[model samples]
Target: MQFQHPELLYALFLLLIPIFIHLFQLRRFKQVDFTNVAFLKKVTIQTRKSSQLKKWITLLLRLLALACIIIAFAQPFTATKTALNTEKETVLYLDNSYSMQAKGSNGPLLNRSLQDLYNVQLPSEKISWFTNDVTRKNTSLEDFKSELLSVSPSQGQLALSEVLLKANQLFSNAEASDKRLILISDFQQNEAFPEIPDEVTVNAVQLQPVNTNNITIDTAYIASKNGNNMQLKVAVSGSGDVPASVPVSLYKGKTLLAKTAVDLSSEKKNTTVFDIETSGNLKGKLELTDPNLAYDNSLFFSINAPKKIKVLSINEVNSGFLQRLFGQEEFAYTQQTQSNLNYNEIPNQDFIVINGLKDIPASLAVALQSFSKQGGSVLVIPSEKANLSDYNNLLATLGMGRFTEKVSAEKQITQIVFDHPLYENVFEKRVVNFQYPTVNSYYQTNTNATDVLRYEDGNPFIFQKNNTYFLSAPINLENSNFQNSPLIVPTFYNMAQQSLAVPHLYYTIGQQNKFDIAVQLMEDEILKIKDSSSTFIPLQQTKANKVTVTTIEEPATAGTFEIVKDADFIASISYNYNRSESNLQYMDIENWEGANSSASISALFDTIMEANNINSFWKWFVIFALLFLLLELLVLKFFK
Candidate 1:
């Protein structure tokens, strides 16, 4: 309680004057003529005593009335805060990630949260609200009502620590304003809670699911190829309760191709394989019935005809091993001697090999530089008796290290970089005692590229930098036997394979996904991706023979989409929502430091309103003064 007019409380001092008058009366009773002194003495004693009692009662009533009126004039009041003049800003972060689809008391957790939001009376006239993918600033309830209704599960989830930074962006730049942050989410266990700023009060509302059991189709992929048919493998996983078996279905467009069941009675994770016999493109989807989360219940994928990578080799001393490795069925192999090679065919290949060239011409070196810049890959195997000037010129122009002096030594290839992308999924285990190939005599070069294979003495046997690869020694059967080793197939195969990255079963949304389309387009032409609902042009670049498309956040919806060049359907691709949300575990909201936790949205808003209310006591004081005056009059007129 506080006083509004504290200076007016000086009137309380005047009540002391009434107290002085009650304590001592200054008037002496006038002397009257006395008659019958003996009889009047007894009556005088009784009358004097009664009159003194009445005077004391009247004095007490008047003092009480005066004190009440003085307090009423002071105008006291009670409030939650000391100063109520500061401006208030509120920012609400609502998490609409896929995990919100879990079931709660009423319905889905997201739907229940929506209803809770609708019931809240705004603490202020306006506020800012944001989700994973959208933001509305300083908007009234009526203004953001539509946006809230349209909020769906999203793949772009922000970590709990990131939410604080995102919400702070919407706050006004007033230094004296009171800031409030309201975070609403399921609070998944993987994210860390951030510390709250002292200037801003944080309120967290965590929604819990009644049942945590959820069965999800985790992923789908082509596990193995069976002749013309492929063995499609689907992995399913669950949390909490375990069912005996879950039926899985495979779909090509809308037609059902095959069905299988994954027995989950004994394991939390299981797999089911389907032998698909289709030979052409398949707009495929894998589906299962899961009562918990609908987002991870279905997986979308695609199977398209193989696109062969083009390989060109310009030879000075031709070796027949290149033709056997780049089989006709998979790679379009073309071999041309330097004397007969046409420069027109340079830009049309994906991977080019300068095979054991004794000397490189200036024209061929210039052509290789242009090709490398346009997304082509090159491998240089230096000859024993080569022109140092011409070979160094080509290497320098391609942003690679130039060869200096030749060192004649017998060395063995003893190291392999199994962690490189070229060697991904190639080795089941690291082999240390395998047969190491040796070179009889080789040239020593100075280069700062990643070593694909190293010698026993730590010199680079084969090094690569970006798209340009170099072999430090010649492999002409007379110099080295590296071509006969088991490492040769995967080493060269993956080098070319990575040059044109093939599209996977599905790409996660909100990530950097890039792939190539093997189609030649005219200048100024473009490519777009579309499904049944919408179409969008991804960030793309046209190389000499293919288009490299990169997507970061486009194709927002999860489904099968086709890459279209003008009117032609180039290939099919797919996108899926992230599966991290399928795990039903939740964070411990009670342990969050420096934050006030609420059970629901409506309760949090009610608390805010109550804190800012000011209860004034001036009116109640006025009523008290009037009642005291009535009591004083009654005591004076009726008590006697």
Candidate 2:
């Protein structure tokens, strides 16, 4: 035990004053006559004993009261070795992520947390404050309090382990004897906690929100396109009980396009489809009316206007079938024989079809390989009796394996890789017994390529390598029956459409933000992406025939954005918030109680105080002193 003001303990000598007064106050009696001697003797003996006992008891109470008062003034307390003898360093971590927007007792969870910090009486020590996006070190608690009011929640998230590690790093070189790290957060379960080191002590304060139920528009996509009307599919997901009715709205820019209400069942996910009119470069958002979490309630997306697909076919024979397949209005199809093959036009086409080519020239093979490398898709259909060496040379240049001798046996394509993007939404149902394409004679090749179509004998009928696809036999009336099969239309169309590299509906934040477009740009041309309020040039690099644009800075909010080359509008892109913050589940503090080192903020504070063995007992001592003085007063006034 110790005293805060040890010098005041010298007041204990004042107790001697009461003792001396009691000794000096002893009465010197004068003789007096009594009425009856026997009666006087008995009364004197009883009164003397009782009077002496009462006087001694009263003196003892006075001395006890004086000692108690002196001890209270001295500020007595107990000290432990772990108590802070020198200046202490404290680090406080406040979570300001989007998840903190949930409502708590006072207001928003983050706002409540800020108020709690304001109400706390900080110790006289150097303090540091940390959040997900900012860190202020070695600031006074008053300054930190002022800064805390101005802080708002951010989209960025910080893990518990990250906070601890950062605090440890900040205090690693500090000279203070006692160091403490206090974290206050909702403790969302999205990020995993790392093992904290034993050298640093941490105090975790979890803020629990009232409502955890949330409904979010997880994603949206273009289901189908029919002229000016496009069908979009939106996925809605929720936690907790399903809402009875969820109102969904679609917006094109600021204009409301469509609105609908969906009846949700017990299922966690529900897909709703809406058909809306769309024109060129549509920037839109799909919003769900959910009050629990406003951040994920709306999903931003973009849709590019339909554009003509350019296709070029090079053939040795005058095959009318090649022209008929790509001759639709949506395609700008051009056909040229091998004699009139133009190397310059290869870069301008979205897809190049090499149909029944007798031999591939060295210059033409090099140009085609360059086309494939620059994001252009190629479909190679070799002639049955074509020059093997020429085809092999072309294949070798493209890093595709060489074609060996042709197989003269007839084979049927019995299996199709339906899961491939080429066959997406093509057939309503899987055809178990359908007419299969037959190849009379096919080239044998040894290559590490994905087989999209396989023969009954487990041989590859069609194989693809990156953007380049190879067919074992030509699509001719004499060589095979593929031209008459139903698979020919979708197989040729999806290849052309996919080669254009359609813009995605949306992109998630905090990821590699790069988009590949089939449009070519000049050397001095600059690509800029903009929304309704802002515009900036993005980092762009042009490849052989396509341009790649990378977003240098992340947008402040999720919305639809447009890409342009100087004054010409290129495409539309959408961005959405990462869904990781939507999960409100948290790690229970009870789980950490079992661990000797881990504890809650309140528990940790109590432990720190206990370990320091430093507590002011002066309040209790003062109460005791006051009670003793009251007892002494009552005895002097009425006890006699």
Q: Using TM-score as the measure, which candidate wins? A: 1
Global Cα lDDT for candidate 1:
0.85
Count of backbone collisions within predicted model 2: 0
Provide the lowest-lDDT 10-residue window in model 1.
77-86
Kindly give the stretch of ten consecutive residues in candidate 2 with the minimal lDDT sum: 593-602
Q: CA lDDT of 178 in candidate 1?
A: 83
For each candidate in the order shown, give its overall lDDT on alpha carbons: 0.85, 0.79
Give per-model CA RMSD: 3.4, 8.6
Q: Please, what are the lDDT tens digits per residue for candidate 2 over residues 18-53?
A: 889888895865545698878888877788888888
Top candidate by lDDT: 1
Off by over 4 Å in 2: 1-94, 117-151, 156-183, 191-202, 241-243, 265-273, 316-331, 386-388, 400-495, 517-520, 543-546, 567-570, 592-640
In every candidate, how many clashes are there? Answer: 0, 0
- Residue by residue across 1-640, what tens digits does model 1's lDDT show? 7887888889888988977987787876544557887677767777778878877777776777777777778888777662364688889988899889898988998888987887778777888999999888999878877667888878877887788888778887787888899988999888677787777789899999988999998888788786578888889998999688899998888989888889988878899999888678888899999888899988999877888888998887756888888875668888888889989999989999999888898999899889988888898888888888988898788767878877787889998878887789999998888999999877677888888889988888888887889888899888888889999999998888877876887899889999988888898899999988889999998888888899998888889999999889999999998889889888888898988998788888888888877777877877877777788788778875
